[model samples]
Target: MTGPARGGADPGVAAAFRETMAAVCAPVAVMTGLEGGLPHGTTVSAFASLSMNPPMVLVALDRTSELLALVRRTRRFGLNLLGAGQAGLARRFAAKGGAAKFAGVAWEPHAGVPRIPGSAGFVGCTVAGLAHGGDHLIVLGNVVAAETTGDAPLVYHRRTFGTPAALPEVSG
Candidate 1:
């Protein structure tokens, strides 16, 4: 609703906000966009379903990220929801300034975007619009194609990756 402080938010306020937000668990996903026939991607925790009727999803990316630029240019992208065992892939994509992030990674093309193999789920989307959100760009995508696997979703919580623990069985 209201914007951040005009001049600058207080350091303590920002720290408190970060600390609080860190406790909230979120799904980990790799957002991929094509760049000159090569795949460019980044790990994203700021992603969520936005609508159902038209099948829309939202992902927030750093404003200056190269992957964001590619998505802006191509107007399309892929989102791969990682499985618990895919932490290595997540770390790889999260790294910066690499020769090729896709090197040694398993992926396939989906609607011209690269989708990580073995991910819990993957979706191909066309950018509907972008919104400025502080240092990030909120990308709203219309899901054109998507698929899901049986694998458990990888989750980010307290700045770490994990999978949800199984629930205890009960008999009524």
Candidate 2:
């Protein structure tokens, strides 16, 4: 990678940054919103809880992503945390098919946003603020509703989808 990648960042630095981040496991999720009563979503791994007092979360979406634009206007969105067994579903949303991606998938509106069934967790949020990041926009949301299914979460590591496991304890 000698030149810039698709987002126009230095390829060398971008590749290195990606590889470095890949070493750390991150949760896999689909950020979902509605466009005129039609569901739209995309896979995202850059989301995290920002605060507990006010119950806030933040997700980073590509600046040019249609889902980002939709959420901006709707002022609401859902984060469906994928379970360990939902790698195929993750890829489905990650692919570039637009509205066509939800053709055969199952989801419904919950707490004013679309929620995918059988996910590890779900959180419906209202957009609180937005900030510009390099190549991505940080959306700060006030969590309105949340639930968990207690399923093991899917994770991304080393450019692959996987499940997290506990390490064996060691004593000397």
Prediction 2 global C-alpha lDDT:
0.93
Off by over 4 Å in 2: 1-11
Identify the leading candidate in terms of lDDT.
2
Model 1 quality (TM-score): 0.91
Worst 10 residues of 1 by lDDT: 1-10
Off by over 4 Å in 1: 1-7, 169-172
* Candidate 2, 23-117: lDDT as tens digits: 99899999999877899999999999999989999999998999999999999999999999999989999988777889999999998888999
lDDT per model, in order?
0.90, 0.93
When summed lDDT is taken over every stretch of 10 residues in candidate 2, the lowest stretch is 1-10
Write model 1 residue lDDT over 45-105, tens digit each, in one string.
9999999999999999988888888899999999999999989888899998432988888
